[model samples]
Target: MQTFACQCGATLFFGNRKCVACGCDAGWCDVCRRMTAVSSDGHCLGPGCGAAVAPCGNRLAYDVCNAFVPQSATGETIRCRSCQLTSVAPDAGDPQNVHRWRLLEAAKRRLLYDFQTVGYPDAQLTAAPPLTFRFLADTPEKHVITGHADGVITINLAEADPVHRETARQQFGEPQRTLIGHMRHETGHFIWMREIEGQREDQSASVFGDHANPAYGDAMKTYYDHGPAADWPARFISKYASSHPWEDFAESFAFYLDMRSVLDTLRCQAPQLVGAGAGDLPTMLKSFQEAGVALNEVNRSLGLTDLVPEVVPPAVVAKLQFVHDLFQRYVAAT
Candidate 1:
């Protein structure tokens, strides 16, 4: 993410609610994609704010969102663009649920920011099969599965807890697992349904296998029962990706986002070292490999594991290129 500065000249991060230097309230401007100071009269001084602004209803009610809504927003309850996409939120009455929900929202906002940065179509709740979220608390009797259906994505609130998520990562033997990763992966499923399913089946199948395969379900079941093939690393980005064609596509999509995000962050911090704008797939992947090496070294110095544990083989690189081509097509169409 790009660095943000408060009106007071103090550095402000994405999740900052108030400027430490000026003690002024801060809210994120979706149009500007930055955190800006909120005036005493509740007007945001950000570039896109021509009218007064108010904290999103979710922020005012539960202190869970830092996004802003223009005062001119119509409706009985005004929500920020991000919050508007949430169809179901976890219970706020429980303190633990509230905290976990906040973590989920934070990750979700970052995911949406990346989507906007990459020029994806805006997710509107009013659209047919609108993009939406359901943050559910898994009960002892019924387990909640985090996945996407139609345009709606469901996340288990337990994933928001670091310890719980770490335990799951160990259980699944995944190299990387985080709330943001989950959001990115699930959003891939949504994008496939909305953008790729019927429009470019031939092109998608060329890289990700046939979506019409009759043994798709059985393949997924067997994958879960036994595990990925020994040569999975030669083609798939992750073990889970080897489960089925759909999963391979989603995994590659998520990896594409991850690489883009890291490269963007590097460009912002060291423009001299890395050029601006998305470069070609090979160039970007090469830069990511170099950066990952440096990042892993730093992590090792700090007594931590590798910053990025996944390896990108030639086959995975081809799949990522396909994902990039699809994104470019969507951007050009829009």
Candidate 2:
């Protein structure tokens, strides 16, 4: 969530198509990875930067993406790195789908940016794990389910509709849910495939139970038939997390990313609170709780949902710590 400087000395934001103060056009430059002023013809006009870039097809056609594709890659790559990761996009013919797709892409952009800031590889690393997305809507013959498999993350288009999403939240008894939360949770599975599945079985089992046992399908059926354990709050981050070990990991990973986002914003905007950045899970969680109290209070005052939960169970914290350490290693190696 770091702000970028425009050539006109105005602050530019990530999704901004034009700088409000300077009236200069702004775009996300692939070279600098920042929102910077761009000329009408697609030359990056940022300070000391003149990389030739092309607007993503989604940007030029749908006004959905604000990023650019490298000019040299125009032949083979018509989309920006973030937009490129999407293998399937919602149909634009439907007016509702257009709005829903726009919101979905917006969330995906923020998710990818969070990954970039947190030191996770997106388009930068050839060795990085495969991660792609599909934004599909339910049809007469097909039910679009949201989940991840073999590096592909499928997000149901309805999630972008606030009414549909809020209904799901109440039905599932979830404290909070959003498009970005869905991205983080599903990417959690993608990361587990690359980093945890075969790489650190022992450590993962120690943190979250053996995912191999009980068979995921059987476990899922049992969970649906007979809700989560009554004492799940003691050991899991969410009731749904108690369904299976894999779910626990994803929930923990998603929450870890959420905390990281919060702490990173704090470090940037309120340096006094963050002090040394999000150091470790323990430190980060402590800072989040301290800030969450105020955040939750503010939401309460405004009659909005709480930004953070009232509790972070010790067991869930351990799982988050494991995830934190795992990614920290990647950061250090990078």
Candidate 3:
């Protein structure tokens, strides 16, 4: 993510709601892609028209979202572009649920920012077959699985709780597990269905296999029953990715976004640092590996585990390249 500065000149972050130095209300400007001060009259003090804006409806109602919407926006309710994608929210009567939902929304916004920064066009949630979200709670009798269907991504609010998420991460033996990771992975599924399914069928098949295979369900069942092949690391980015062709594509896509986002942030923060090819996949991967090594060493010096534990093997690298190429095509078309 790019570093942001408040109008007061204080360093700000993407999720900041108040400027510490100036004590002014801050909101992200979708047009400028920066954090800007909100004037007393509710106008954005950033670039563009300085239009009168209102806090997201979700924020006014539940104190969750930090996005803003034009005050004159049509409709009975005003929601920021990000909140407009949420079709359903968890039970807000419970305060804990509200807090968890807020965390999920924050991560979701970051995922959206990453996509926007990388030139992915927003899938208009106002259009037919809109991209949407459903944050659900796990009941006493049943567990909620995080998955994507149609254009809706359903997230179990439990994942927003670090304790629960960490326990699951340990249970599943994953090197990393995060709410943002879940959002990125599920988004891959949505993009595949909406943008890639028919458009790049031949190219996708050559990398991830045909999604129409009759054994796809069996493949998933086998994976859950017995787990990934021992040599999965040789080809797959993660064990879950080895379950099905669709999953493989999503996993690779998620990792591609992860790498690109981190690389972009690094470049912005340390422009003097060279050799990290920002646009070329092969050179970027090489730079990533080198940076990972140095980062791991720094973590070790601080008596912590490696910052990035997964190794990007050659097979995974090739898959990542395919994803990069597909995204470039999508951007060019747009």
Candidate 4:
């Protein structure tokens, strides 16, 4: 992530609420995708305000909100745009909700930051229909489930627990798992709706296969009953992807994120890997492969399987090239 500087030229993190050098209060505007300063006395949560928006109720009582809301707000409580993506929020009345909500918020903001940094301009947190987050209480009477629907993402509050999350990682057989990973994986489902639009979706269908064919409910039932398909690793990035087409899309999206982030990290940690070139995806892919090898060697020295997997077969690499070409064409057409 890039660091932001205040008007006075003092460096600040992207999420800084106040600029220490200039003593200016700052928050991110989803619309502008930049930091905006708020007046010292009070700030507006209005539509145009660039401040990182949150729930007004949290602000009034807790005085800890950094969310921006619409100027036309006329309700008992106002929710921020990002918060609206959540369909399940922990009970505000419950004190434990505060800590759990904070954890989800941090991960969600990070996901948004990464999304915006990439080419997806339409990604934003809004309060209109509201992107809601529900942290479900873990109780025997209730079955906690986490997923996204419409604009909402539901996360089981138990996932925030170290033991619970670790257990899930083992159960799912995922090499890497974290709250951020969960958010990234789920957001993939949300963005897939945007990616597979128009005829391109049909073309994507040819590659990823038809998503509409399955009795989705039945497929999910069979998946949970019998587990992911055998030989899943040969074809899929993760076992879960073998469960359904939608899941494959999400897994592929998550791998795309992993690629971008790992590439960025290499650019910083090993400039030699990037070399002296700005190239298209094929060229970038070659450079990235070299970087990946170097990174893997380093990991091996440290006794770790490369956190960045080298699973792109020759055919998969070509598919990645196709995606890169598609992205370039998209930018040109837009």
RMSD of each: 1.9, 2.0, 2.2, 5.0
lDDT of the candidates, in the order given = 0.84, 0.84, 0.81, 0.63
Model 3 segments beyond 4 Å from truth?
73-77, 123-127, 273-277, 302-305
Q: Total clashing residue pairs per candidate?
A: 0, 0, 0, 26
Clashes of 1: 0
Q: For residues 1-334, what per-residue lDDT tens digits would candidate 2 score against the true structure? A: 7778887888887779898988877878877777888877878987677888878888988888888767874354487877888889888899899889889898888887787778876433234556889999999999999999988899999999999999999999999989999998998888788888778988999889989898899999999999999999899998888999999889988888888888777787777766585576677788889888888998999999999974887877788888888778869987
Please give the lDDT score at residue 123 for candidate 4: 27
Query: Over the stretch 210-251, how does candidate 4's per-residue lDDT look in tens digits?
Result: 777786687788889999888776667677877877777677
**Cα lDDT for residue 28, model 1?**
88
Expressed as tens digits, the lDDT of each residue in 1-334 for candidate 3 is 8777766778777787878789888877655556677777787877564867778889889988887777764645577878878888999999999999999999888888887767776654335577899999999998888999988999999999999988998898887889989999998898788767778877887888777773877888898899998999998999888888899999988888887777777787765443644657887777677777877898989997676677888888878988888667767787
> Model 4 reaches what TM-score against the true structure?
0.73
- Top model by TM-score, which number? 1
Question: Which residue segments of model 4 deviate by more than 4 Å?
Answer: 6-10, 18-26, 29-32, 35-80, 123-133, 195-201, 225-230, 264-272, 275-279, 287-289, 293-306, 318-330
Comparing 1 with 3 on TM-score, the higher-scoring candidate is 1
Off by over 4 Å in 1: 48-50, 73-76, 123-126
Per-model TM-score on C-alpha atoms? 0.94, 0.94, 0.92, 0.73
Model 1, residue pairs in steric clash: none
